[model samples]
Target chain A: MALNFLIQLLVNGLIIGLLYGVVAMSFVLIYKSSQVVNFAQGEFLLVGAWACWWLLAKFAIPFYLAFLLTLIFMIIFGILVQIIILKPLIGEPIISIIMVTIGLSIFFQAIMNWMFGVFTEPFPTIFNTESIKIFGLNVQTAYLMSGLISIFIMISFALFFKKSRLGLAMRATAFDQQAAQSLGVSIKQVFAAAWAISAMVSAVAGVVFGIVNGISSGIAFMGIKVFPAVILGGLDSVLGAILGGLAIGLLEHIAHYVDVQFLNVGNLIRIAPFYALIIILMIKPYGFFGTKDIERV
Target chain B: MNLKNSRPCGDFRTSYFKDMSMFEDKKGFFLTCFGVFILSCSPLFLDSYLISLLIYIGFYAIAALGLNILVGFTGQISVGHAVFFGFGAFASAWLNNSFLIPVFFCIPLAAILTAFIGLLFGIPAARVKGLYLAIATLAAQFIMEDFFSRASWFTGGVDGASAEPLKIFGIFFDSDTKYFFIVLFWMVVSFIIATNILRTRDGRAFLAVRDHYLSAEMMGINLMKYRILSFGISSFFAGLGGALYGHYLNFVSIEEFNIQLSITFLAMIIIGGLGSIRGSMMGAAFMVLLPEIMDWLTRSLSGTSIDSALSLSEAIPFIKEASIGLVIILFLIFEPNGLAYRWGQIRAWFKLYPFSY
Candidate 1:
């Protein structure tokens, strides 16, 4: 019986971990291109999920159409934020940049709370079958779909960075701004594009997460949770984020299993990643994939 | 760093002793004295409610001043300051309740305890710098928050902990008006200690570290020691401020210290002026009063069409919350130097009223 429960937890961990990877990927995309530690990354999810839900519930539109509109809306929203708020802070000190992003996060989170109310709202029923049996384990259809979508997104991200013309420009920009500028790449467009793509991708993750769990202010916490994953994977590496997410997810579940079986102490799952983060930082600091920076003092 | 810029028109210092004095001149000294005198006497005329707000402003300013020492002076970023502040609160309450330590003495004792914990967390800071350091502190924030919840003996777990009123000899300070004085005493001392520290060799070392770590290292400043020392000192003041805060409320709850509150502390320092001593106080006062002003504004406008349509009463909590972020962003974008710098600019304008220069 205990083994079955542990397997069930493992499956749950894998699904959620994939979703974490999707969010972490978008987070890394922004950090690599723009060099801003977006405190509002979770707000991106909140905004996107809320936008899609509002469209579906208020406009009574079909799920596919609302999802499309939300993506379009997020793209514009992302661009606008980059151009208006972040652009002004380009040459500012690190502290200034950090404060601005934090400010943006608080402002957006509060505004969302006010508009949507603090209640968790469920997404309209899009999937007819609630759960499907796979390998003798019960899995929610939404979880399975989220898992598939996350994989699809990851593959597309790999392709986008490798093959697309804009992706190449972004890579060049991230590599060296002056060299990229000299090579005729516009930094302005690259930044805006990075934010736009990140926002759009996060919206998809947000919508999936909202479908799996009811959408509320609680969903915004994914931004904070991404920290441990990214730190484990390497802050600037896209591939690291995915692996880190899976590891953290499995770690959380295993910790939970231990607590239920022997410790009986609760809330370990919420805090285990932080302990792992501290340990990783102390031992490695650079993580498995992060590039080590050489500073000239 | 240019000493000549801050002095008034004809005030000249002929010796190093004169130059290194806390006040630039007797006039500046007198002005500060006058300001404090007015604040000290405010309790006599102001109501208890107003006095309560002042007490809050006092404690928050003391804490903000500590943050300024770390972020502004030493150039170390911490997102975990609120947890440290919470630790102080819990520590003071526990010391008082467990060992029967006097609340008066518990305040400083709790501060010392928090400084030790700050040093423990500052270990991560010694290894990481900039963004990495910021993330590390964030992890510390979560870890400490969990500790607070799990260790019920210290924080009283979910029930929170109770704190006794401060007593001096046989006098009990429970009222807001009486508590105001204790807060003021601590605030003045904390600011003075900060000012004197900044004027010392150790303080210069902190400035050196912030300006250029490599150069500061070459100049014989121990990079790791100063960074960690700065964290300890910063937490010292954070603990002091938190103790005052807990005793003032007569209770300390785990929920009070979180990421949002930590960000609010960051906002205080940023809005007031990063690295400025007076800016910390000004920023703290501004933050403490911002929500109250919003409440007043909302109350007066409650029956208006826009207010009725938006249901502004229900939105007050959100509006207040949003304003903190708005102010932080606006200040960073438009007034990155903070209100202290702005105040200096205004003073300079008045000093050179007719001249274009």
Candidate 2:
């Protein structure tokens, strides 16, 4: 019975981990190109989820159509945000850039609260099956769908970066901007593409999370929760993001299980990721997949 | 030493002592003194509401001053400063409630305890820098918040802990006017301490690390010590400010110390000026006043030139948030050094009025 429960927890954790990885990908995408740590990444998820939900619930659009529209809208929104707010801040200090993103996050949160009202709403069950017994364990259909979609996106992302022309340009820009610019890569275009792609990814994560859990302002905290995953994977590594997300998700579930079954400690699951993060940072600051930045006098 | 062209032409110093003086001329010194006099006495004529606002501004200034030491002076960014502030609140509340500690004793005791906690958090800084340090501090924030929520006996859990009224000697500081003096006193003390620290060797080490860490280490500076010291100093003020805030509100809750509050503290330091002590104060005042000013402006302009469909009351919070964000973005893009830099420019412009260049 205990072994079965552990297996169930593993399945649950992997699903949540994939969701976190999706958001972490959004974070890493922007960070890779612009060197700007976009604190507003979570707000992208909030906005996308709200847009998708609004279209589906308010306008009575079908789930796929609403989802597609939300993705497209988020892509445009991301590009516009980059062009307007981020472009002008290209050469500023890291702190200033960071503060701007922080400001944008607050702005987005307040705007969302105003638009959506301060309450949680259960997402429409677009999936036909609410739950399915997989190997004698109950699994949420939304979670399974989200996991599969995330895997598909991840695979496509790996391929896109490996094969596409734009992907090559983005990689060059991330590796070294001056060299990339010298090679005729438009830094502006790369930045815009990065933002657009990341926004779309975050939108997918948001919609999936909203469907699996519920849509609310509380969803914005996912960015903070996902930060540990991002750090654990290595800040600049896309592959690291997925692994870190899975690890954190597993850790959280295990912590929860331990707390309930043995220690009876309250809120250990919430603190577990940070505990892992600090220890990991102490042991290897660059993380598993992050490149070490050598400093010299 | 005169690095910028905007510096006033007459500002020439003959000796090291003269160069190191806080004010270049007697005019600046007397002006500051006169300003302080007016500020100290203003509560007499002002309404209680304005006095309360002043108290909040004072505490924010204290917090921002501390933040400036770490971010501006030390070049380390922390997005989770609210955790330290919240820690101080709970610490003071516990000391006051359980131990029957005096108001004066609890404030510093809480600050020291908070600083120690900050130092513990700062351990991650030894291995990380820049954005990495930020994420680590964010971890600190989440961990601290979790502790607050789970430690129900000490922190009162999600329900929150009530702080006893602050009493000094036989006088109870319950009224806004009475509390205004307490906040003002601490704010001034914090400013003086920060000023003194900035003028000392450790302060120069912070500046060196900020300017270039590689060169700072080459100069034989202990990076870990200064980094942890900066965190300690910053959290000390955060805790003191948080404690004062609790007493002012008469209640402390975990909800009050969320990431948004931390961001606001960051916003205060950025909008005011990053490295300047005066900038921290100005930023604090600006942050506290901006919302009130926006509310008033919206009330007057509502349904006139603005949208008729959306109610002004409903839109006020969004407007407040967007404006703050916009202000930070605009300041970062146009004037990265913030309001203090602008103030210096205006002074220089006035000084060289005929030439104007």
Candidate with best lDDT: 1
Over B1-357, each residue of candidate 2 has an lDDT whose tens digit, in order, gives 667545557768889887777776777789988987888898879999999999999988988888999999999999889989998989999999999999778888998899999888777665677887788878877888888888988899989999988998889999999998888889878988998898889999999999999889989998988988999999999999998998899899889898778888898888889999999999999999999999998898877746566666678888897778777777777878888999998988888887864
Off by over 4 Å in 1: B1-14
In the range A159-274, model 1's lDDT, one tens digit per residue, is: 99999999999999988989999999999999999999999999999999999998999988898889889999998888999999888888888889998888988888888888
For each candidate, give the interface RMSD after superposing the true interface residues on Cα: 1.4, 2.1
Query: Which residue pairs does candidate 2 place in steric collision?
Result: none
Candidate lDDT values, in order: 0.91, 0.88
**How do the residues B1-357 of candidate 1 rate in per-residue lDDT, one tens digit apiece?**
898656555446789999889987778899999998999999989999999899989998989999999999999998889998999999999999999999999999999999998888776688788887888888888988889998999999999999999999899999988899899989989989999999999999999999999999998899999999999999999999999999999899999999998998999999899899999999999999999999999999988998989999999999999999999988888899999999988887887776726
Q: How well does candidate 2 reproduce the true complex, by DockQ?
A: 0.64
| Tens digit per residue, CA lDDT, model 2, A44-144 | 99999999999999999888899999999999999999999999987877888888888888888888887888799999878787899987889989888
* Model 2: CAPRI class: medium
